[model samples]
Target: MPVDSCHFRTKPIHRNTLNPMWNEHFQFTVHFEEMCFLRFAVVENNSSQTTAQRTLPLKALKPGYRHVQLRTQHNESLEVSSLFIYSHRTEEGPAGGATASSLVRFIQVCCF
Candidate 1:
């Protein structure tokens, strides 16, 4: 799965509780929505390894809020670990008032 401007990171919650929230927002331009996977990862500060992660296939996503279940690096599900997010897809024609043959699509994601 290929994505444009795909890499994004959120600020750490810094709290000691099991349920942490960042309320981060991110956007990405995807060329092919059917062949792309939206991947989310949690990493500690100054560490390259991911603490937990989840991947969602764009083709299966519905426009609305969703609770995405997360898993450990070894692909084991973590109880009560998930992401609450809202995602929507928008389509636009070519820039500069050009023809509509080439449409651009953007996926806007908001996490809370």
Candidate 2:
């Protein structure tokens, strides 16, 4: 996707757990998937401070379930922090003699 950046926060924080299963689905439409980067950040509810985050290029991700590593604000890897997610990419075929295909897809992510 030809997106510079997209940000969103998970809702209704699951209390008393390091691993939170969000089961949330997100979709985006863009011209080129290779130019997009997906960023996920975890924040502390009370203080609104981001605890961990990760950024990955859309083209570098493989379809299906995967584990993404998380890091601290300083860019240091948080040894045990990661996100379990499922990504599916679909391109619509040219319709009604249209020359360009529609780029749309869904990505499901769960936090840890």
Q: Say which candidate scores most in TM-score.
A: 1
Model 2 over residues 75-94: C-alpha lDDT tens digits?
89999988888777666545
What TM value does model 2 have?
A: 0.78
Candidate 2 C-alpha RMSD relative to the actual structure: 3.0
**Model 1: per-residue Cα lDDT over 1-112, one tens digit each:** 4435478878767785477777878888877666788788888776778888987788787888999888998889988898899988888877676444466678888988
Global CA lDDT computed for model 2: 0.71
TM-score of each: 0.80, 0.78
Any runs in candidate 1 off by more than 4 Å, and if so which?
A: 1-5, 95-101
C-alpha RMSD of candidate 1: 2.9
